[model samples]
Target chain A: MNIPMPDFMPALPEMFLLGMTCVILLLDLFLTERSRVVTYLLAQSTLLGALLLTIMLYDNSRTLTFSDTFVLDPMGSVLKGAIYIATFFVFLYSKGYLRARNMFKGEFYILGLFGVLGMNVLVSAHSLITVYLGLELLSLSMYAMVALQRDSVVASEAAMKYFVLGAMASAMLLYGMSMLYGMTGSLDLTHINQVTAAVGSGQQVVLAFALVFIIVGVAFKLGAVPFHMWLPDVYHGAPTAVTLYLSTAPKLAAFAMMMRLLVDGLGGLHAEWQGILVLLAVASLALGNLVAIAQSNIKRMLAYSAISHIGFLLLGVLSGTAAGYAASMFYAITYVVMTLGGFGMVVLMSRAGFEADRIEDFKGLNERSPWFAFMMLILMFSMTGVPPLLGFWAKLAVIEALLGAGGLTWLAVVAVIFSVVGAFYYLRVVKTMYFDKADAGAAAIESTLELRVMLSANGLAVLALGIYPGTLMALCATALSH
Target chain B: MSFEQILFYVFSAITVLAAGMVITVRNPVHAAMFLVLTFFSSAALWMLLEAEFLAIVLVLVYVGAVMVLFLFVVMMLDLNTTLLREGFARYLPLGILVAVLIAVIMGLAVGQNHFGLAQVAAPAPHAASYSNTQQLGELLYTTYVYPFEIAAVILLVAIVAAIALTLRRRPNTKHQRVDQQVATRREDRVRLVSMTAEERK
Candidate 1:
């Protein structure tokens, strides 16, 4: 009853971005086709302004606002900054593609901004209700974005599938949450943690059931195995630009959701949840790696690759240690960087009539453009977890975390074996680019200079980070420690 | 049994029967009507539990708005009931398995033994003058105002998404462009006659 008026400063970035998104939505309506640039510029500046505000409002100590529904802390600030940077690059890459297809409109930018806002709220959520609302907003925006190219029946079908499955998963999550609420008498994560820590094993049956449903929901969101039927279809069916955006930043939000519900909220149930996560991780690793080798479509292959990467991400969180959490964060950030580049290349080579989504499309890419091919090589190698690449270090961090868990040595071994299997498909992409003969009159790269520069930077940055992982690893450690 | 207990049993039985009919009815409109009945009976049952606000809201929202929308869509679509029922037999085994599993789980967690009157004392009824709605409103607006605002934003998003998805510019339909009309210039509409009149081919 005596909760003071909560300080609004912790929420300024979200508020600022929300207001600017609305202003741009209105401002775009009045602008002519020739002046569509204004809308794009406004959207870009909104992200920049939000990033600036996030840094300005950054606090070393954790702050809870909105009556303890929202949290602003080092982890949230870091993740928000990553989302902004990733979205900034995604928007820049999407422009030329949209313009070429006559799909350049304000809706894409507006929906993307809303999606970012959803991710922002999700990463900082301190309550079950906040997490649910944030997840819905993000999922809705993504569904709309997937169906943005209205003339494509494939896109529409994919959107329908994604929406239906996503809704069902969310309902399961809510059902589990209701059970937890009944048990704990609170929806606040901190309060739930406190209540759960004191509960006896007599409630184990109900708790185990709740954990299963919650894990199912989280696995579905992360595109882990058995719950990942929608991923390949949605990824392959959406516009490559939308796919690029969807695959990159949303992973961070899902990671935050897992951290909140599993770590912050229900740490007392770690034994049960961790067992479920291990099963999901192994299943995802096996199915993802094995199925990816058979896929001829590049998007579907990457979708499977994403599934396998999620398995690695889970290895860290399943460890249930601070070191593991920090490693998982590092893996998520690096995965986003690598995915942006890999999908960016797919977007770059695609033109008005060409989708450039087949494995053979990259044949002899080196002969066409050696520099771009090398950039892709860096991305592919990093994804394969080859030594001296960013992905290698990401995997190593999680493996070490698992080893430190002491009892999960078998899981660590399984992860390493699957990573080796995963390497084959990634290497095949590189082989297709360098050794295979070029098709007659293969389309030339006609992307804008901005996209080209950004894509190259995105790819090379993985290499740069691989060489200097110390700073970023330490940053993750610091963020998770607080 | 007392009159209140007898009424409770009657309403709950009706609610269960209607809910069963909602899935089993052959006609789509009939199914929707059964759903409305189910909602009404459930609302009555909530009233028995002294949750007047929940009862009224359930009736007003579910029976009034949501069921009407469902009926509208069901009527608008020309669905073939025989074709819809074609896969029912094929999937019956799987469906039954799932149903049985869910029943067992629910039984273990919230069956009569866990939720019976013996386990939970009945809440004392409030005076007739007391208002459940006012208490609900006070808590919603004060303690849960953040979620209320978030719900508003979600509704706004639904509106924007609906319009964005369905609204389209049809090329077959012709409409005047106000921008072109307003930006009209003399040269754009009609050229000067100084040297153009004699140049007809």
Candidate 2:
């Protein structure tokens, strides 16, 4: 006659973050500009505190609560922990940059914190409705964040583009989800998977149509080629602080969404959606690598690079194997680290008048400061998939997963070639930093000791992980194995 | 046709006609009014489907509330819609192409090829005693509670974001502050000058 209540323990971290975000929002309203640093502290502590809560609540088994729409699993917890770390760096690096440009406001931090909460929800989503809800929550916050710099025409345009396209994507996803519901008679992924797996070819045509729409929606969110039109413009148009927030953390959420929808929900249609991912992966690799070379703006270049990394990320997913998913997860973590460091450097170089977003801005970084130059070198090299960096192992893991999948070897070759071409652009960055002469009036490197130390450590993590990538990969493997 | 079928066709046809008029009408206010009619007809069609909760909510929310607010906006904006639609002709072919594509795809999606009784068997219809509202409420409060709360957060974000973007403290603007007005006293806003009458000379 009555159902048991859902467990509150699995969702403790999300609950904690949401409460703190509201508290910080109110706290910021009353504080003067001089004490506004408290907001930053509170937001950072919220992330740290959530991370702690997640660690405390971590269990090896999948824990479903809240009507089984939300599932806290090994993957969700690990990915959420990754999101927290990435967002931590985003806020830390954005502090000086936003303050210098007079764009520092409580709204940015509040929205960013909300974005993190959205990503957290996204990572744990277990049902069609939860997935869409999380995606919309994440998307809306990003739209607001992009348009936060309201005075900038470019930013406003970017926000408009992102909003329109994101809404269209959400519609496609909802359409697909409703179709699934109609066909399978359930919105829960576990039930959908069982029904779909048993239905076989009974309704393959409609199922394939639904699959296409879902793939399109997922690809759009992941910024794969063909649906990646808004990524670069949004990245380049947004304030650097916003770009810093946009480029990190959310990738984990998007990745989790992919796994939940494609791998878990529609695993029965692996034959259909696998091919779609292959096409997206190849196109993204070719187009992203080739196009990034022509980009003079560093933000646009990184956006394209994000696309290429997504290509690699898809390689792991499309393999439809535990090893491949783990590889993808490993790749996502490494990419986030490299992107954070890369964008952190961009933010560090920027000051009041100059936006260090142009490729030329990195010229003679060695002359400016050899230590940070070395740091940038490490990040660029890692991005190039050079050996002895975390990125190299990530690429190898995916390529190996492709080989493990037997017929995906050619796709792996395509990925390898694209990586080689990708190296040209990433290495060009390093070359410019080391080879080119500093501008005559180039100012000396200036930043807080804290940013310098954290950034250097960020760079070193890539190298350190490259030397030993087992622990993270094992974590990813275990998360997906169950 | 039976009377119910006849009424269903009438409402659906009106819904389609009004929807088309929403886009083609020259006047923006006319378009808004057309949109309202479209909502009304759609609601009527839903009423025929035995989904009273949805039908009532559609009429109450979309037709009664949203459309009225939309009409007010249209009447207030005084838009130069003729100038705005100048490019409508240029984009008509592309727009038609997309619309046709979507129509065909949607037709296939819900069409007989995939969704008919012959292709996929339909579930048994609900009994007269079944309450769609009760079922929906059970799901919303139990299994879908997470999404319900997330939706609340999203609306909160929307409210915060809209205010953040549009609200500004310009100090230069001439808007009155109610708090300042309420705080004013005899000694504050009115300095009791002893020789105020002499100033007129």
Candidate 3:
């Protein structure tokens, strides 16, 4: 058989990332521990370069590459740009935390770069094998990152659970793919669509089973209800910086993937998957909100809160239209900003040798640091979907899409109720800061001026996006239009 | 029988036997090793089926990289073999039940011929120029692109999750912040002084 030569020009982002990772690795090896700043700078610069390249190469019309396994278009560009920007912030936010933990090695930056590359590949993937390759690359890198803190028992246990569960999810996805392949005699989405369209209603049941199996993988990635058992423990166990990273960029990528797979690939059978997504959405909303209220740990609470947000995001997908896809994309972008800001606040409050993870840790914070308290207030409000903030706009877009789709009023009511319930925990953080007494023995909350400035900008962006969400919404809509 | 048929049976036997040993091996390391053998033999079977690309990749990735990592971890860990054996008796009934159920399911699936195995014609000696991998590649690159991408995104999420889990804060360590390190200049952290004997006092 003749070997297919891949065209390299369309793979610019991945190639850039691969090159950058190697350069960062080399720099880390030559530089002293104190001089590891170069690695961080390199990572940020590389991400910015890739983001720029993605924008420059943005094509509204779909252009398949590598024999049709990858497609470059508006959707790919938007997702890639968002992921790159998120990774940039993730690097910035992680610098202080990694240094504090003495895990600020070169491998961190390399792995992160590779992970970004994987995400880029995933967002553009046009075939099953390419998808698996991209996914495995990302997964292997992540497993290494999770076990970076080799000495922690909790970290190890979290890693183990994540690995086992992740493997199971992957297996389910693979099995689903196999079934689809067997049924359609092709792995291409277009071919499958043709085959599925031709098949009678009787074959829909098999398709439904395959779709459900595939959705299981997506739900697990989103940390929605029933598949959410991993989130709280993983979040609470991981470093605050890592948690910040986890809660942001990857969610956007996952949403992009779900849209590409379910909405585009299996769109002909939306009736079946829509019901499943609705169930997942309602359960995620109810369980995520109800369970979060009792959590004392800030990270764990946010994890649950994230699960609930996944429910809202799923609402957008359930709409099963271009508008729904746009809303989901919009929700993902808003979530990234809010989550990063929230986790950034947690990082700022933390001092060396002391983790500011518990809800009580923020008590009396207003009295000591009014500025930080206000920032925290804005972040919490945004996360709680309070009006005039980014989170509220995200929720509105999703609900609007769901309503437009029609006949999901009960699901909408569940979402609204859970949003209200979710408000309690967000407000609880605010109350602790404003009304509760400060702990005398707590470590001083001193941070570098750079961190303070970045954190403020990050937090304020949420408010800015909330007030003028038109630009972001327009971008999301345009991205999904193709 | 033809040589090709004989070879197919040989690889098939090896694969099945290795797979069975993967479950029955008492030592966890041995079990893992058996799994590797099973993967290799199955890859050979794939080769026989004219899926050379997948067969080679299966060997390179699973047998080479994944299994090596598995073996490294299994060997490094101080596993209590005695403790493992102790649980076997207690879980024997449940394990047997599960094994039997799996066997029944497998039997039914193969017996029902739902996999279309019976419809697959015996491969001709000079098959089409387009190999299994080539067709797979064409199909994936062209049609199945969306699912492929979705899979990639799922993997990205998993990666982030793993990193987030393993990155824990330790209370006692002192490390330098990247921002602080970058902010410093030669003049700030280093001093060059020329001292005269009289001024030195």
Candidate 4:
């Protein structure tokens, strides 16, 4: 199947990202450590630049480039835009944290730009091999990032676990792809879909197994239950800046991969995969929320909370409709905002030589800094799905999609129950901040101008979105319109 | 019965043997080395399948770059073989059980009558033009373009995530900023004076 390259420019966002990354790398080399602010500004500007390019390229028309392996469409554009914006904020949030840690290096900005580039590719990939390439690129960089704090045993251990588990998932994904290739004689997802659509019900059993193996890879990436053992440890062990980036950006990209592969590539096999996803959704909700209540470390708690949100996102996938896809995308976007704010608070509360990761670290936060505490209150409430918060709208969209899908009443109920359980933990953070007494020895919250500005925006955005979610929802719907 | 089949059997045996040694080798460094051997043989098998690009990449990236890093880390760590082996006896029965279960399931799943062991297809007369590498390249760059671009973006995000995780500031450490060092010139600290000795006095 020879596809003539479209006359349209190939990979506009990719070209922009590569060009920006090089410029950032070269420019950072000349910036003094005292002027590390320049690197931060350059990195943020690069992400913003990429985001603008993505928005400008958001046409509904689909074009295949590099001959057919790369695609440009509204869906990919919106996802790329979200990833770039999320990355921009992560860069902003990390600046002060990195500066305080004495490990501020140009490699951080250069590598971050590359990582964002990889995610853009993963979200737009339409072939199995391309998917693997994107996944491996993302995984390899993450492994190195997790181990960046070489002096910390916890970080090293987290990296090791991540590497081993990630490798196993990659192998499973590869084996599944090979099997699919052997059966269909093609690596193109469209071809695979056609082949599977023609197969008999009995033969579909083999396809089902292949799908299970593929979902194992997806489950690992999403940190869904039964494959989520690594999330809490990695989240707790990584430095706050990395944790902020990890919790926000990867979730969105992983959802993009899922939508491309499971929804678009294998939509015909929805019956088989939906069953598996329902089970996973229920399990993730139960395990993630239930386990989180016991965590003393705020990062670990949020990690579990992330797992449960994956469950909510999976509900949208189980719906198996365009609306469901839109809802899932919205859920991912909202979750990114919530996570950034959640981790942004962690960054603000932390000081040099001390990581403020424990739930206890926030005790008396309201008394020590009322404004920051109020900001955290809004974020926590948003995460808990309280009405009039962005998180609430995100949850409402998914639940409505699930209800509309029908035949999933039990799963919907489980989702609600888990939301309650998850809320308990988020609320616990609020209680620690407002109800409890402040610790006399608690570290003073860092008052870097950038941190303050970003944190305020990150937290306020949740409220703003919650109140006027129509715009985000409209964009999501447009992207998933197909 | 043909030479291709003979070569397949040879590489298959080497792959399995090296893979077994990867687990059995007591030293972590040796185990990693054996794993590298396993990867090389696997890549050779991929070449036999006519996937030249994948074969070379598997060898170069996984076997070369990845495994070299693995070896470097394994050698640097102070590993205790005895401590690692202490739980082997306790876990051996469970491991064996799981392994056997996997073997049985795989045997049933891919039995000759199930998945069917069809003979490999004969290569087309124009094998040179229909080379796996060329075909794959054409397909990836053409029909699968969106996915290819998306993959690149994911990789970029991963790079960013890595940098963010490792970059930190420590109050106790003193580090030179590149810009500051570059700003210094020969004339800034070392002034050329007509009578340097008299000036010093």
Q: What DockQ, between 0 and 1, does each candidate earn?
A: 0.35, 0.68, 0.07, 0.26
Who wins the TM-score comparison? 2
Q: Indicate the residue-level lDDT of B44 in model 4.
A: 86
- Order of quality (TM-score): 2, 1, 4, 3
| Model 4 C-alpha lDDT per residue in residues A195-312, reported as the tens digit of each score | 8888777566567767888999999999998999999999998888888877888888899889878876778899989999988999999998999999999999999999999999
Clashes (backbone N, CA, C under 3 Å), per candidate, total: 0, 0, 13, 56
Which candidate comes out best when scored by DockQ?
Answer: 2
lDDT (CA) per prediction: 0.90, 0.90, 0.80, 0.83
Q: What would you estimate as the lDDT of candidate 3?
A: 0.80
Ranking by DockQ: 2, 1, 4, 3
- CA lDDT of B65 in candidate 3? 98
TM-score to true structure, per model: 0.93, 0.95, 0.83, 0.86
DockQ of 4: 0.26
- Please say which candidate is ahead in TM-score: 2 or 4: 2
For candidate 4, the lDDT comes to 0.83
- Write the residue-wise lDDT of candidate 3 on A69-107 in tens digits: 777878878888999988888888777878888878777
Which lDDT tens digits does candidate 2 get at residues A427-451? 9999999999988888887877888
- Report the C-alpha displacement of residue B70, candidate 2, in angstroms: 2.4
Off by over 4 Å in 1: A1-4, B1-8, B112-124, B174-201
